[model samples]
Target: MLYIGVDLGTSSVKLLLMDESGDIKSIVTREYPLYFPQPGWSEQNPEDWFSALTDGIKELTKDCDKTTVDGISFSGQMHGMVILDEEDKVIRPAILWNDGRTQAECDYLNNEIGRDKISAYTGNMALTGFTAPKLLWVKKHEPENFAKIKKVMLPKDYAAYCLSGVHCTDVSDASGMLLLDVKNKCWSKEMLDIIGLKEEQLAKVYESYEVVGTLKKDIAKELGLPESVKVIAGGGDQAVAAVGTGTVGEGMCNVSLGTSGVVFIASKEYAEVDQNALHVFAHADGKYHFMGVMLSAAASNKWWQDEIIGTKEYKKEEAAITKLGDNNVYFLPYLMGERTPHNNPNARGTFIGMTMDTTRADMTQAMLEGVAFALRDSFEITKKLGVNIDRIRINGGGAKSPLWCKIIADVLNVKVDKINSAEGPAFGAAILAAVGCGKYASVEEAAGKLIKVIETTEQDPVIVAKYNKKYDIFKDLYPTLKTMFDRIAE
Candidate 1:
C-alpha cells in the first residue's frame, strides 16, 4: 500500500508519496503567499494552504494507481492560530508561529499572572509565539471575531479537518499551544479558563500515529483516491522531523538548521528544565521530548548573503572561510529576536569585535560559529537536567555544509551524524501514516527501519577547546546587550 505525507509549511505545502517499504515514489511542492500586515506580524490564509495541497496531491498521484493509497498524515508549522466560525469558515488569516504581535499578552501571562503559575499549569512559560497568547490578543483586540469562533485548530489540523471532516490534533502539535497540560497529556483547564476558551473549542487530541478518520467522500474522489483512505493525526514539524531522522527513544538528539534551529532530545519520561528555558513536550513516538528553539539559524546566513552581501553564491562565500576557530570577529545570531534560553523579542543581530582588518570571510565564519554557540546555550540547559546526549542527528539546509556541521560537532562536543535522506517533516508524516495503516507496529519501529545514517562528524579536542572559550564570550553578549535591545525597541 501507499501512504501520503502532507507537510504544511509556512511558505508552502509539500506532498510526498511513499510505498510501504519507505521508498519515495513522488514529491510535489506548492508555494503560497505569507502576508505581513504590520512590521512584526505574520499571517496566512488557510484556504491557500488547502488549495495548494489539493492541487499538489493531484499532481503527485497522477502517474500512480490512486486506489493503492492507504492513508495520509501531516506534519506542519506549529502554534498558528486557525479559528473557524459556526459555519466552518476561516474567521481570519492565521496568525503564524513567527508572528511577534503577542508581546503584551505574553507579558500579562508571565508577569501579571506569574511565570511560576503559568509554568505550573502548562509546563511552559508564556511566549509571544504561543497560541494561548495569540488567542488572548485576539480576544482583547478583535473581540467581534473572537465571539464568532467555534473551532480552534493549528495550521496542519486545519488541512486535516478540510480533508477528513474531523477536527483533530496530535499531542506533539498541541504541546506548543500553551493550552496543553504537557506533563499530563491533556488540555489545561486553568489555561483555557484564563483565556476564556472552553475545551470543546479545541480539537480532539490523539497520539501522532493514531487514526483520526477516513477521507471525506468528496475529497477522496477529488484527489482520485479511495474513500477508505485513513487520515492519521500527525505531529508538529520538529517532533515529526525527529521521527524522520530516527531521533526516537531515550537520549536521542537531532539538531535542525533550517530557517529556525532546534536541538531536540527524546526522553523516556517528562522532564522540565530550570526556568522553563527548554520546552517539555510530547514526542511523536508516544513518549516525551525536550526542545530548544533558536528563531534565526540559516535565516541569519540568508539575510547576510541576500540582503547584506547581495549574493546567492552561498557555497562560494563559505568556501572562502577556511580559518574556522581562528577568526577574531564574533556574531550574535538574533536576526529575529530569539527564543530558547533567552526568550527575548527585543534582541537584535550584532557583529561584535570587528576591526579594520576584519575580512568578509572572518564575518562569515563568525556567523556560522555564532549559531553553533547559541545552540550550545540550549544544550547546556539539557545537560543541567541530567539528560546525557552524546551524539545528534543533523538535518536542514545548514547541515548540508560540511564546515557548519563540523563547527556544530566541535562546539557541542558531540558526534554529528548526517542522514542519507533529508526529507524532514514530510518523510516523518508518511511514517506515521504507515504505522496508522498497520504497516509497522509503532513510530519507533518505522523510523528504525527507514532512517539511515550516511556520515558522522567527530569533534576535535583542539577545536573543541577553542570553541569552548569562544562560546563563553558569546554567551555573555546577550546579557550585556539586553538592556540596549529593550531601550532601542522602546
Candidate 2:
C-alpha cells in the first residue's frame, strides 16, 4: 500500500507519495499567497490551503496507482488560529503562526494572567504567535467574529478536515497552541476559562500516528483517490520533521534551519517546568519534546544574499566565506524579534563592529556565524536541563551548505548528521501514514527502519574553543541592545 504525506507549509503545500518501505514515489508543491494587512499582522485563507492540497494531490498521484493509496496525513504549520462558524464556513482569514500582532495579548497572559499559573496549565508561557493570544486578539478587537467561532483548529488540522471532514488535531500540533495541557495530553480547562472558550470549540485530539478518520467520498473522488484512505493524525512541522530526521525517543536532538530556526530535543518523560526558556511540548511519538525557537535563521542569509548582495547564487557567495571563527563583524539575528530565552517582540536585527577595512565576505560570514551563535543559546538551555545530546540531525535550507554545517557543528560542538532524505516534514508525515496503516507497528520502529544518516559532520576542538569565546561576546550583544531596540520600536 502507498501513503500520502502533505506538508502544509507557510509558503506552500507539499505532497509526496511513498510506498510502505519508505521509497518516495512522487513529490509536488503548490504555492499560495501570504497577506499582511498591517505591519505586524500576517494572514492566509484556509480555502487556499485546501485548493493547494487537493490540486497537489491530484498531481502527486497522477502516474501512480491511486487505488493503492492506503492513508493520508499532514505535517502542519503550528499555532495558527483558524476558526469556523456553526455552519463550518471560515470566519475570517487565518491568523498565521508568524503573525506578530498579539504582543499586547501576550503581555496580558504573561503578566495579568501570571506566567506561573499559565505555565502550570500549559507547560509554557505566552508568546505573540501562540493561538491563545491570537484568540484574545480576536475577542478584544473583533467581538462579532470571535462570538461566531464554532471550531478552532491549526493549519494542518484544517487540511485534514478538508480531506476527512472531521475536526481533529494531534497532540504534537496542539502543544504549541497554549491551550493544551502538555503534561496531561489534553486541553487545559483553566486556559479555556481564561480565553472564554468552550472545550467543544476545539477539535478532538489524537496521537500523531493514530487514524483520525477516512477520506470523504467526495474528496476522494475529486482527487481520484480511494474513499477508504485513512486520515492519520500527523504532527506540527518541527515534531514531524524530527521523525523524518529520525530524532525520536530520549536525548535525541534535531535543529531546523529554515525561515525560522529551532533546537528540538526529545524526551520519553515530561519535565515539569525544567526551565522557562525552552518550550515543553508533547512529541509525536507519545512522549514530550523541548524546543527553542529563533524567529530568523536562514532568513537572515536570504536577506543578506538577496536584499543586500542582489544574487540568488547562495553557493557562489558561500564559497567566498572560508574562515570559520575569526571575524571582526557581528550580526544580531532578531530580524523578526525573538522567542525562547528572551521572549521579546521588540528585538531588532543589528550589525556592529564593521570597520573601513571590513570586506563583504566578513559581513556575510558574520551573518552566518550570528545564527549559529543564536541557535547555541537554545542548546545551552537544554544542557542546563541536563539533556545530554552529543549529536543533532540537521535539516532545512541552511543544511545544504557544507560551510554552514561545519560552522554549526563547531559552534554547537556536536556531531551533525546529514540524513539521506531532505524531504523533512513531508517524509515524516508519510512515515506516520505508514504506521497508521499498520505497515509498521510504531513511529519509532518505522523511523528506525526508513531514516538513515548518510553523512556526519564532526566538530573541531580548535574552532569550538574559538566559538565559545565568540559566543560569550554574542550573548552580551543582545542584552546591551535591548533598550535601544525597544526605544527604536517605540
Candidate 3:
C-alpha cells in the first residue's frame, strides 16, 4: 500500500508519495505567500495551505494508482494560532510560529503568572512564539475575534480537519502550544483557565502514529482516493523531522538547519532541563525529547545572500569562504530575535569585529560560523544536563552545504552524519502513516529500517580548537548586546 505525507511548511506545502517499503514514488511542492502585516508579525491564510496541499497531492499521485494509497499524515510548522468559528470558518489569518507579536503576552505569562508554574505545567516557559501567548494576544487585542472562536488548531491540524473532518492534533505538535500539560500528555486546565479558554475549544490530542480518522467523503472524491484511507495524527515539524533523520532512540540527536536551527535529542523518558531552557516535549516515537531552537539559522544565510549580497548563487558565495574559524568577523544570528537558551524577542542580528579588510567572504563565513556557534550554545546546555551526544544526523537546506556541515561539525566538536534522503518532515510523516497502518510495529523500527547515513563529517581537532576560542568570544557578544537590543526595541 502507499502512504502520503503532507509537510505543511511556512513557505510551501510538500506532498510525498511513498510505498510501504519506504521508497519515495513521487514528490511535489507548492509555494504559498507568507504575510507580514507589520514589523515582527507573520501571518498566513490557512486556506492557502489547504489549497496548496490539494493541488500538490494531485500532482504527487498523478502517475500512481490512487486506490493503493492507504493512509495520509502530516508534519507541520508548530505553534501557529488557527482559530475557527462555530460555522467552522477561519476567524482570522493564522499567527505563525515565527511571529514575534506576543512579547507582552509572553512577559505576562513568564513574569505575572510565573515561569516556574508555566514550566511545571507545560515543560516549557512561555515564549513569544508559543500558542498560549498568541491566544492571549488575540483575546486582548482582538476581543471580537476571540469571542467568535469555537475551535483552536495548529496549522497542519487545520488541514487534517479539512481533509478528515476531525479536529485533532498529536502530542508532539501540542507540546509546542504551551497549552498541553506536556509531562502528563493532556491539556493543562490551569493554562486553559489562565488563557480564558475551555478544554473543548482545543482539538483532541493523539499520538503521532495513531489514526485520527478516515478521509472525508468529499475530500476522498476530490482527491480520487478511498474514503477508507486513514488519516494518521502527525507531529510538529521538528519532532517528525527527527523521525525522518532516525533520531528516535534514547540519546540520538538530529540537528536541523532549516529556516530555524534546532538541536533535537530523543530521550527515553521526560527530563526537563534547568530554567526550562530546552523544550522537553513528547516525541513522535511515544518517548520524549529535548529541543533547543534558534529563531533564525539558514534564514540568516538567506538574508545575507539574497538581500545583502544580491545573488542566488549560494554555492558560489560560500565558495569564497575558505578560512573557517580564523576569521575575525563575527555575526549573531538573531534575524528573528531568538529562542532556546535566550528567549529574547528584542534581540537583533549584529555583525561585530568587521574591519575594512573584512571581505564579503569574511562576513559570509561569519554568518555560517555564527549559526553553528548558536547551535553549540544549545548543545552546551544539553551537555550540562549530562546528555553526551557525540554525533548527530544533519538535515535541512543549510545541511546541504558541505562547508556549513563541516563548520557545524567542527564548531560543535561532534561528527555530523548526512542521510541519503533529505526529505525531512515529509518523509517522517509517511513513516508515521506506515506505523499507523501497522506496516511497521513502531516509529523506531520504521526509522531504523528506512533512514540511512550516506556521508559523515568528522570534526578536525585543530579546527575544533580554533572554533572553541571563537565561540567563547561569540557567546559573550549576545549578553553584552542584550541591553542594547532592549533599548533599541523600546
Which candidate ranks first by TM-score, i.e. highest? 1
Candidate 3 per-residue lDDT over residues 80-136, each given as its tens digit: 999999999999999999898998998899999999999988999987888999999
TM-score each candidate: 0.94, 0.93, 0.91
Could you tell me which residue pairs clash in candidate 3?
none
lDDT of 1 by residue, 294-335 (tens): 999999999998999899999899999887668888899999
Model 3: per-residue Cα lDDT at residue 45: 100
Model 3 Cα displacement at 5 (Å)? 0.2
Residue pairs with backbone overlap in model 2: none
Q: lDDT tens string, model 2, 1-490? A: 9999989999999998999889999999999999999998899999999999989998999898888999988899999999999999999999998898998998899899999999999999888879999999999999999999999999999989988999999999999999999999999999999999999999999999999999899998898888899999999999998988898989999999998999999999888645478989999887999989898999999999999999999888888986788887899999988876788878999999999998989989999999999999998887777889899999889999999999999999999998889998999999999999999998999999999999999999998999999999999999898999999999
TM-score-better candidate, 2 vs 3: 2
Candidate 3 accuracy as lDDT:
0.93
In order, the Cα lDDT scores of the candidates are: 0.93, 0.92, 0.93
- Candidate 3 segments exceeding 4 Å error: 33-41, 303-329, 353-363, 488-490
